[model samples]
Target: MTVRLRPTLAALPAYVPGKSVPGSIKLASNENSYGPLPHVLERIAAAAENVNRYPDTNSSELMDALAAKFGIGSDRLVVGCGSVSLCQQLVFATADEGDEVVFGWRSFEAYPIISAIAGATAVKVPLDGQTHDLRAMAAAVTDRTRLVFVCNPNNPTGTAVSGAALLRFLDEVPSDVLVVLDEAYHEFVTDPSVVDGTTLLERYPNVIVLRTFSKAYGLAGLRIGYGIAADPAITMAVRQTQVPFAVTQIAQVAALASLEPAAERQLAERVAEVTAERGRVTAELRNAGYQVPDSEANFVWLTNGPAEAGGIDATAFAAGCAERGLIVRAFADSGVRVTISNPAENDKFVSAAHELRA
Candidate 1:
């Protein structure tokens, strides 16, 4: 007989990552196409020499570097396999069976999956104008609500909430509820009004800010990310739920190298390039008659136009791009998300957008 699995497993939606075709220009996953700097590569190679040995379970050196970089106490920070792992750990930290975890729909795709795995109910509030509707989300929170995720510069949509709106939402949430600001794309944000989640820590003790080395730092393959909790207790809970030695030595050292002054400056330049390209891409798509959002992250979101107006929905548009040797993420019946890359790759995406425009 087959072993019985949790009944909730049946209804859970599998996470579909961006497609990667060998010969195609990939703008599917919101990944930085620019590779690591030479110095960081050197560090990764050096770290590889000691793979036979176990990684430090605590990732002490890396943790120290991040703590110092952010001017926070070491006790307030915790590292994980990626910010995604921290996302799961946060669910484990505050959520229990039947408790509700509220977040905006069309935000990070992982929120619902993780909440379900933890036996917590996922409460998805629909976005207003392709952006987080903070008022609606805050209103959805109840006493049973244990955790809330605000993916600022949201994934797949590339839209972020203003600081003022976020503040209003925060004021509405109960002080006992945990608010997680997943800023995996923190490095790519160009908007001045998007609240830096870190700055909210002092006033909101329940707040936790997550960041990653995978984006602009070009460390996606290595898998390392971290979170800073406003309260040491929350940090402690996240740490307690972490898988042992999940952060590898190579990832740890690579992240440390990426934080070096020279590396930081170089990475900042790369982010500037992506943001510049993002603006160009959005404008180009709009000019081509696509409904594109003002993106703050290293990607642009295009709403699927009305089918009655000879428009194509997300799936059909993605299929069209695939035929043209370009791969982009398509949220069925919703929109398409195209990652900003180097000039050549981005130009190919823009051309595809024009050809596919309704």
Candidate 2:
């Protein structure tokens, strides 16, 4: 007899990471170009000495650090291998067959995948323009909805919804349903109107905030991220779903070192640089006649091409950039997301964009 697998796996699409071409400037993945500070590197190297021992599955020291940093009880936190892993854990913890998970259509690609893995239906609400239509999302929520993910500064688009609209949406959602604020790009957000997800935890007991060391903290390879759960029950559920000792000791040490005051100050300056480059890139794309969205994160979103180019779609634009030794992430029939790197790298992208437009 042939071996059988879960039938749902057939419909699930494999996640495609950004392409890497030798000698090309890759602006496809939304990663920090900077590396960890010298002190943090030293800690990570030192921690590597204890690799023979399994990591603290509870991650006690790291948990305490995060709890104190956010002024939250240790019981309300869960650290995962990465925020992406936590996303899956949240779905597994809450959803089951016949239940539903809701998120914006183009927000995070993994939302639907994770929901499907949990044997739950994925209910995607389309975006209004480049941003999430909160009213539409609120309307789409049914009694069967178990979790809702709001990816502020959405991926592949770089658009963020305002705080007021988010608050209204939260109020509309049923208190029993969990609303996840995926703030992987939190450090790069410069908008005052964009609500910090952590600030909403106390008032909204159903809220969970996911942040990462991958972006501004410059530890993408280390893969340490955390979730702030307003409810201890939710925290417990997410923690229970974690892979045993998935987080390594090196990752824990590097993350803790990154949280130190000196390291954080330096990282903040680096983030400021990225945001400034983001502004420059957005303006340059606009000047080249590309339809660019206002981005609060460390990247810019390019929609339809200039009218002069017969309104080319993202794929075509991405191909043009690739030919010019630049790699950017493109969504089929949607748009392109270009990461903001250092000034020189941003200039190369701008130059390529201008050439493509012309």
What CA RMSD would candidate 1 show? 1.3
User: TM-score, each model?
Assistant: 0.98, 0.98
Cα RMSD, model 2: 1.3
Q: What is the lDDT of candidate 1?
A: 0.90
- Residue-pair clashes per candidate, as listed? 0, 0
Per-residue alpha-carbon lDDT of candidate 2 for residues 173-275, written as tens digits (9 for 90 to 100)? 9999999999999898899999998898889999999999998998989999999978999999998888899998899999999999888899989998999
Error of 2 at 171 (Å): 0.6
- Write one digit per residue (lDDT tens) for candidate 1, span 1-358: 9999999999997999888899998888888898899999999898899999999989899889998999989999999999999999999989999999999988888899999999999999999978999999999999999999999988878899999999999999999999999999988887889989999999999999999988888889999999997899998999999989899999999999999999999998898999989888888877787777788888888886784432458888889999999998999868888889999998988887777764
What's the residue-level lDDT of 283 in candidate 2?
A: 83
